[model samples]
Target: MAVVRSLRQYVEPVVFGAQMACSFFDTGLQMVVKQRSENATSPSDPHEDQNAIANFYMIFNMLTDFIPILPALILARIGDRGYRKVPIVVPLVGYSLSRALLLLVIWLEWRIEVMYVAPVIYGLCGGFSSYWAGVIALVSVSTSEEQRSLRIMRIELVYGIAGFLGSLASGHLFQLYTVGMKQGVLLASMSVALYVFCLLYATCVLQVSRITLERRESTSSGIITHNRQDRTIIALLFISGILYDVAVAGGVQILSVYVLNAPLEWSASEVGYGNAAGFLIFITSFLGMKFFTRFAVSDTSMIMIGMVSFMTGIYFMTFVTTTAMYFLARSVMLFALIPMPTIRSLLSKQVQGTSYGMTFICLQVSFTLASVATAPIYTKIYESTLDTYPGFVFTLSSIITFLSILPISVVGCRAAKQENYERIQGN
Candidate 1:
């Protein structure tokens, strides 16, 4: 019984890691397929084709992000009302179905345009925004306040490690050969298999943290009311987090297009390696947080440090001409992963136990809204500058990231005032 209970404790994180790995692998493989299809059709002008395809891809992603807001809110409300697994399990099902559609596209040699349907299906099932919100809510409610950051980081570490391994192997998997098999079919199949496993584990093995349930019951009545100052700080923090996410999302979306064209025509293998480098950011940021917390750094300070690191790295990326330079830029952004998760931890701490799901829902909504605006803007910028300066998107990202710091500064000051006030009251 003891061993069984101990093993059960590991199931949620394992499932989360598996889901992340498969998602990243699927994303990388999808990019390769899109690139290949575009290349096959427009062999004379691969650069122009790449820009067009990238725009289509980002538009599809933006639609998925936009369409899911209502459904995500509904699912998150359900989860908060005691059906936590619904949000997680349903998204895994959607993910598996979407990946399976890609396999069909590969095997049947369907038009690349058919791929657009998959994101709509994914959105109907609540999409990644809902899934991640549910997972964060679970982590937030389960852990104690003091250890919440570390606990969330542990999940993030597993997610990063899984993505690292998946990305390292995904390119090689795309190159796999088998009798009567199309290129990338095997990789897509593997992604579907992993999603299936994740879905099953989440359905059968995962349980709500008992501590979370107890706290929710005990604190249900008092969770909604907060004084004006904390509310102001949280609002500023959310605004900052949303802007920062916009920079991150726009930068990553354009980076894919940038790497696939012009001076750096990376192969499938090289793309995987680049993605692995990106995944390493999570591991390094986790380590940075651990080290800084040991020295008693505040969450706001950690967030400021991370934003600075991201801005500097992105600024450097604007001038990257070679693969080595790209990787070097990624390395400089090692601490860039800190701000989002730390902001999440801080937000979770501000609210009462029963409000975790709602808080994360708002965060997801903010991200969705940011994506709606940023995706098309970045896509247009990349398309227009394809001839002259495709890397201009990174410069824009750095500017937006720099702007994100102002709200963080406001949040930090407000938090400090609250802390000092509590200290004085305690005396």
Candidate 2:
């Protein structure tokens, strides 16, 4: 009973369920888009079908990344004002409604173009940017500074595990159909139902409390002079984060469409398995963190290790021709999940606890803004290289990943200097 009560304070349940729903929706939408595009284009021109799918995603992803910016900021402000759940609950509502729209499209045979409005309604309610930042803010304020990194990583681990399980089942679920129902109806309906569960869980069950505004204002007011080093570190962290995100997001956005094309030509089940393989990094990363932390590894060092892992893996991705080679490349990225959460943990340490929501949202919104330019550019690159060199975008991602490492190295040098100075001053 005590354990159950203790667990009641967590938001992991909502993360788990919502991620599961997202996995289902992702597979369903991908296969649906594939089918529709194939039906509209001649089989002789596979490149045209691939381009159509890529074009749909280029706009769809932009809307997903762009529309939520203002609402997310507003919701973050509200979260900082004391209503912690508002940021989370509102976005879950958007998630549920948007996923339900897909279900309608699947069941009624509406044109896929109708789905464009989904992100609009979703963005108005604050979207994933607000939702995740809210969750991180709550977790950051509740945990001690020393334990924050592990706590955040644990949350990410739960999110990944849920996605893995959902992806494993999604392919089989997508094939479930009756005479009157469409192929994806069951999967789409499951996504809607799970999102509704997440909404309810967030609304009524997930327990959180407001960080005291008086304390926050007092801390802010009391710090008359901001530390120059801390500000520099924050700026550096943001730069590293933005560059890494652009690489990962642009690469992933194209990879999804790439798998559905020739050479691999992955079926629904294969696609689900491939996504599930990607989520495995979360588990491996969590384990890697535990091992590294036990050895007293610095956060920046851990981040560098993760960055290198992704760099190598994405470079290898440029040469993937067989399914086995694809998995081998994925296996090389075992630590790729470490950088972002650890970066967030580092950012949380640099700010007052009360500003966690706003700071995290600023970082997320920055990622979204970068994606606005990079997503379309990646699609264009993919389209241009489809027949000759389809993996060019992956190679580009690897280059960006290497570039992201430079700012982080600067951060490591600055952080070490600050620590040594503080130690000498104390002595």
Candidate 3:
């Protein structure tokens, strides 16, 4: 807002437009992706299919994010004067139209075949945001390798706390006031309307920085090293973040279904409370870095440990037959949030300035993949569970959750050994 006031009139409008464009497109593509995923027949190898679809979203979302800059960033380096604006604007507009169309589906009540559209709409929105863009870019351009996750933790800390609060509020509202889909839709609509105002203000009010061609070429050239280690770490993060995505998208849809039917016998409101409880754990993680860092476990060790703990939490859900037990299990899982920031900071530290965008992109990619992978897996598992004891649905989720940790263990060990080797080399 301040930036706009100092520059030109209606700068806020551009900012707003940029924002609107992102919201519009992000929602749009997500809807289409999910619509397709949901309609596809449940595969025999549900896990494999889930993993594939999830990974596609993960990669596509990230590519839509950082990869969009290749032409502008790289071209600017090569003295392609006119190409600079192309990178920033083209995707923004593309994302916007996509979102608008996606929302239209929901508003129009698209047929049953388009059922998965909502989650995809939500996913695309995340892929095209200032929060996602600026923070990642900042870390890539300015931060060191070791500190990326720490900063990411800070970001996630804010994210966790805010998310936790929102979850609690939403849960409480649903539980307390009996808010359902109709109210939820009204609330969302109001939010979109407010967003319209924000878009106009930022675009019209914000000042733009004029860049010289020579400086643009020089900076873009020196911005990122394009190193192999950086790329490898990214690949690992991309894979790991999927764990989170699957837990999120699948958890919301499938867990709700499972919990509503299980021995826990939680009502809709209680289910909301359960989710809020998990977010509470996420929020507590903000304090984890302060107290837990002294274990002197490096970030990689912590990530490995966190993943194990996270999987353990999911595994415990399988055994839980009562709401009391569910509460107890989630409480213990609070410790797992610590690793989130630790990993995020690791990536942030590795890359500086705009390059953190690359790291951000990696994390987002993992997130998208998780969502895609879980879609079919959830449908298949749910179907199978119907044939067995319905309670076993939760149990199956636990197995998959814990099984996912094996990869993290391998990655963590690799990272830990890498740090030790670097230390030995330094000596």
Candidate 4:
């Protein structure tokens, strides 16, 4: 009985590990397919082929981001209604199916274009947006308001650690037994198995806290409203959060392809290493938050620091022609992870406990919409500049990240003014 209880306690971590493993596999597999597709098409020029394949990849991802919004919202609403596991379990099922489809694509040597269908299926089943919103809601309910940021960051830390480990091994897995079997087949198989385990574990072991649920129910109808100034601050935070996420997503989605084509052609192992470096952003960002909090730094200050770190790192990426430079650029952006979680934490504080699901849902919707626009635009810019400056996309990302800082700064100033006013009134 004790063993069983201990195992139950690990359900969330197990689910998170599975999800991260699948993501690593998907990332590596997509890179492999992109390269394979470019080789098979044999365009007149290598750069043109690269451009076309990257555009297709971005478009497919954009579709996935856009198509999942409605289903994700519906699933989040259902989760908020007390069926919390529905959103989590359904998305796992979708993820497993989509990963399986990639295995099929590998076995049959199908065209990469057919892979787009997998994401559509995954989106219809609720996708990452729904899965994440549910997880956030569950975590939010499990902790007090004072503990919320730390709790959420702890979850993200688990996610990052899992991603880092998975990424470190994924490249080796992809290249394993390359002589006896198809590349990435073994890795994809492992991904599918992990996701299947995730689905089963979540269904069988994860449970909602009845106390938290009851509290949420009692408090659902009593969310407090803010003054106009405060409302403006919240709105600016939301806008900045959306823009920051879009820039991050667009930059990351194309990073694999970017490294694969450039003067610094990285091998599968190198790709894994590069990805691990990116995952480290989560760990470092969490640590940075803790460090800042010890000094009682304001949330807005942390956010601004994160934005500047991201902008600086991305700008450096535009000049990266060597692997060392790439990793250095990533290292400089360790603080980049601060903004999103801080923004989410702030938003959570502003709303009623019961509304965490809806808040996350709205955030995901805005993120998706921004991604839909950003992906295609970045893809077009990257493709157009393939011959002259393939790294131009990074420059654009840096610029957009800089723009995100404006809204955040506005919110910060408003917050400072409010604090001063409150202190004066108290005197």
Candidate 5:
């Protein structure tokens, strides 16, 4: 309780959560990705491989995240019991060991010799390091039911703000380093250091933390009591995660390059900075929930409502040629979902104990599949002459993303209406 109280008071969700979003390809993300992907066959051209490897890195990270997301629910279900820690703790060690090796590989610059070493290392490091979902699950133990919905909001909100700031920070860092410090391989060395820092910090936190959940008596108490009742919230999480990734990949990653390449060739760092500025507007999620609580009316509704805003935002983005227009498009991506808070809250109501960790983990899996599916989905949808129709890819994504929202929207609307009627009757 003391530790929980301390964390709640000292660590605002946004600040602590920002750690994941703070760095990017420019500051060190690219180097990390490259070092991670070094083992792959040399691309015919180095330039094209940059984007491709980065995309592939997402696949690796998704795999690592998949193992932990559900474990989060279980860990929370187990609470402070030593067993809760087992599922998460054992994996944490395995993950850390792999990450440490990745850092060592980068430090050695083994890619220069084997080339493919980076890719193999990337996969190994990526498939292993997955403390994020479990971290979320542990945090869940500290929060009350009322806070769970808001916690979901914080995850999205903080990522938006932190991602933006990191982009901005990376831009400045890149400019400073490239002009004054170092470039290319030297830059890769710096990223290796950063990874070490992240790994070290994670280890220290895990080691020092005295926090533990109060143990429930029996294993049955922690097991999911929901009886697999078909719930609207569960379905919505799965669907929303998929669409969210498509939106992120298409709107943020792919479109940034598209916009930048339109007239001027923005360097990687510049692109990173621009992306941060756009995501900063997602701070609106905080405002949406805090002031206009109606915006995030429900978790189930977030996917539906966010989808409409997101798809429209993407359509609006396709026509955008300027950096400012790109920002506008990304901002829409930030605030499209008003129903997320409500929906997450609904989830808290449904899931109890370690099950919360499992549910959240499942959502992570959804995001993973969605992120990995991007290239395949894009390739399958388009004609071979996709080069001629830059807009075709964006357009296809919009249509599919929009279509994906229908089922969730229906379930969410029904829930919202039922809740409204119940309120009226109480009055």
Candidate 6:
């Protein structure tokens, strides 16, 4: 019974399976968009195809980030009310349905624009914003404050490993179509099937408990005294997270389109390999977290280290014309995934355990809202500079990354002062 209960507590199954499915869906969608864009062009122009692809993704990403706001908020509220599985399971339903639509599009010879509905339904069902927040909230409640960051990173590690394996297989699976079936049919089918499994597992097999306030305050005086400082820290973390998200999102968005054009045009297999390289960062970041935690490094300092790692790597990304240079740039970003999860861990400490769902959702929603502006602006920058210097947007991303570091630096300084003050008080 004890072993069974322990096994039931594991959320990694859903995390791993869902991320694997998403990997297949991502590669499949990109290839489908590329195929449709090329087929629709009157003249065989790579530039036109590139623009079409970029335009499609810009709108696609915008709707994805925009449409989930209200639904995700409602779902988060519900999760905070104790039904944690609702947010996660409902989104899996959307995932299963949305991914199935891609299979239908491929199998039925439907127009590519039909694929846009996927995000609408996905968003309406609460999308990644609610689902991810719910997962984070669950993890936060289950672990102690001291171990929260490492546990969250472990989840990210599982997610990344799943993505890496799925990506390595996706390109070949996408190319495995027969005369009767179309390209990506098998991959999409597998994606839908995996999501259904996740949905069922989350609904039936996974066990979760609602977390209440960690401790009852003996007096309200301590709470009042710390409220202002806590709020400031929370605000700074939000700003830092938003800025970092924008930089990463913008650069990655452009990179997907960039790799398909000009000097380093990558094939489906190469695209999958490139994606795998990106997921490799999660492993490095998790290991870095462990090492730093062993040495008693502060979370804020870890976040700064990650921001600098990304800043340098993205700046280098501006010069990557060959695949070798691209991977080299990626190598420098080994800790890039550390900041966000660490930020979430810090945020969770600022509030009562019962509010974890709402707190996390707010952070996720902020990222979503910020991405609304980020998508189109980055898209325009990429489109405008496609001819002269396509790598310009990456440089712009590098600048934003540097700006993100400032807020985190302030957070680190504040934490240092608090630690010193506590030591002096103890003395």
Top candidate on lDDT is 2
- Cα error of candidate 2 at position 291, Å: 0.8
**What lDDT tens digits, residue by residue, belong to model 4 across residues 279-361?**
88989989998998889898889999999999999889988999999999999999998898788878876776667788888
Q: Which ten residues in a row have the lowest lDDT in candidate 3?
A: 75-84
Report the lDDT tens digits of candidate 5 across residue range 1-427: 7786454422234233333323443345454444444446475654454445534544444454344444444443453343433334444344334434433544454442233333343333223222344455555555665566667567656666666766666655544444433434343444444444444444344431334344421222443353235566567655655665566555444553354333434565666766666666567756666654555455555546666776787777656656667666666665564444444445545665445556555555566556655744553333232345555666666776676677677766766776787699999
The predicted structure with the larger lDDT, 4 or 6, is 6
TM-score of 5: 0.70
Query: lDDT of candidate 3?
Result: 0.47
Ranking by TM-score: 2, 6, 1, 4, 5, 3
Q: Worst 10-residue stretch by lDDT in candidate 6?
A: 212-221
Deviating ranges (above 4 Å) for candidate 3: 1-135, 139-147, 171-186, 193-237, 243-252, 262-268, 339-341, 348-355, 391-427
lDDT of 3 by residue, 8-66 (tens): 42222333334333323333333333444445637575344333344444444334433
Candidate 4 ranges beyond 4 A from true positions = 1-11, 178-180, 216-229, 421-427
Worst 10 residues of 4 by lDDT: 220-229
Question: Which is superior by TM-score, 4 or 6?
Answer: 6
RMSD in order of candidates: 2.0, 2.0, 8.6, 2.3, 5.9, 2.2
TM-score of each: 0.95, 0.96, 0.61, 0.93, 0.70, 0.96
lDDT of 2 by residue, 1-427 (tens): 8787667678899999999999999999999898888888898975889899999999899999999999999999999887888999999999999999989988898888888898999999999899999999888777766888999999999999999999999999999999998899999999999999989988887776444334544554344234423788999999999999999999889889988988999999999999999999999999999999999999999999999999999999999998999999999999999999999999877777668889999999999999999998999998988878989999999999999999999999998998898799999
lDDT of each: 0.81, 0.90, 0.47, 0.80, 0.51, 0.89
Predictions ranked by lDDT, top down?
2, 6, 1, 4, 5, 3
Question: Number of clashes in every candidate structure?
Answer: 0, 0, 72, 0, 32, 0
Q: What 10-residue stretch in candidate 2 is worst by lDDT?
A: 220-229
